[model samples]
Target: MHILQPRHIRLKKEEAEELLKRLNISVSQLPKIFITDTALPEGCQKGDVVRMERKYEDKIYPYYRVVVGSLNEKKNG
Candidate 1:
């Protein structure tokens, strides 16, 4: 699992699409992070950058960083 940094970016669907096209990548390529709530706020859609953190536990492991993109639909309920 990856996390998003500088987590909040506001952009419309078209803008996000254009960015993806320009970057030659899809949402899956980016990290998966989302707002605290399961559902995005009104007027806010997917393809948004969100801040997140991940923890690793191992004797020889080092800290890692991540960036989240594209909000997923609520799973339960």
Candidate 2:
């Protein structure tokens, strides 16, 4: 991990649902994060949601991304 990069966190099912509720969107509508992303926490699986707290210029931004298998991974069944 980069010195300045925040850790990528996996969310529990409840937390993931809460995040989706806050955004008024379903997990399928969320952005994708490649499974190979270095920040991804170990043991994370496809279709999981990750929370990344990015820090820049002393500001911390919260970002939620859905883990996907590949660049063209499908979001819906």
Candidate 3:
């Protein structure tokens, strides 16, 4: 049986805009996370935006990350 997992989802266009407004950062400024993560839902693609929700204290917090290519595929400086 599956035990626990982090909440992962793609934001709608409007939601993405709201997040950017709240964070004061652009999409490129957001950090990258793995789309291949087992805790994530399938069908995620590179460059897709992902929102991760975590519960802490008495409230749930949302974090945003972008899907990126594997380490082996990263461009070298």
Candidate 4:
């Protein structure tokens, strides 16, 4: 992980559930991060939630994203 890159962690099943309840939002509602993203921790799969910790002005802010498969763009000829 690069020094400037924020820390990314995959939440456990129970933790994810609690977070959803606390936020009153479903997993699908969270922002999406591709499964191939280098910042994402290993062992992540579809429907998994990743928590990103970003620091600014000496304060840490948590960002959440749901793991999703890569999108394949089809060219219409």
Best by lDDT: 4
Per-residue lDDT for 10 in model 2? 97
- Please, what are the lDDT tens digits per residue for candidate 4 over residues 26-76? 988999998878889989998899999999989999999999887652233
Model 2 alpha-carbon drift over 4 Å, by segment: 71-77
> For every model in order, what is the number of clashing pairs?
6, 0, 0, 0
TM-score of 1: 0.41
Cα lDDT tens digits for candidate 1, 1-77: 12532233355557667767977978677555354444333344344633223334533322211233334435532
Residue 24, candidate 4: alpha-carbon lDDT: 100
Candidate 4: worst 10 consecutive residues by lDDT? 68-77
Q: What is the lDDT of residue 28 in candidate 1?
A: 74
**Regions of candidate 1 where Cα sits further than 4 Å from its true position:** 1-7, 37-77
The numbered model that scores best in TM-score is: 4
- Tally clashing residue pairs in candidate 1: 6
Alpha-carbon error at 4 in model 1, in Å?
15
Error of 2 at 31 (Å): 0.8
RMSD of 1: 9.2
Runs with alpha carbons beyond 4 Å of true place in candidate 4: 73-77
Model 3 C-alpha lDDT per residue in residues 1-71, reported as the tens digit of each score: 15345588887768888888988988889988866566656777877778887777668787888887766
Sort every candidate by lDDT, greatest first: 4, 2, 3, 1
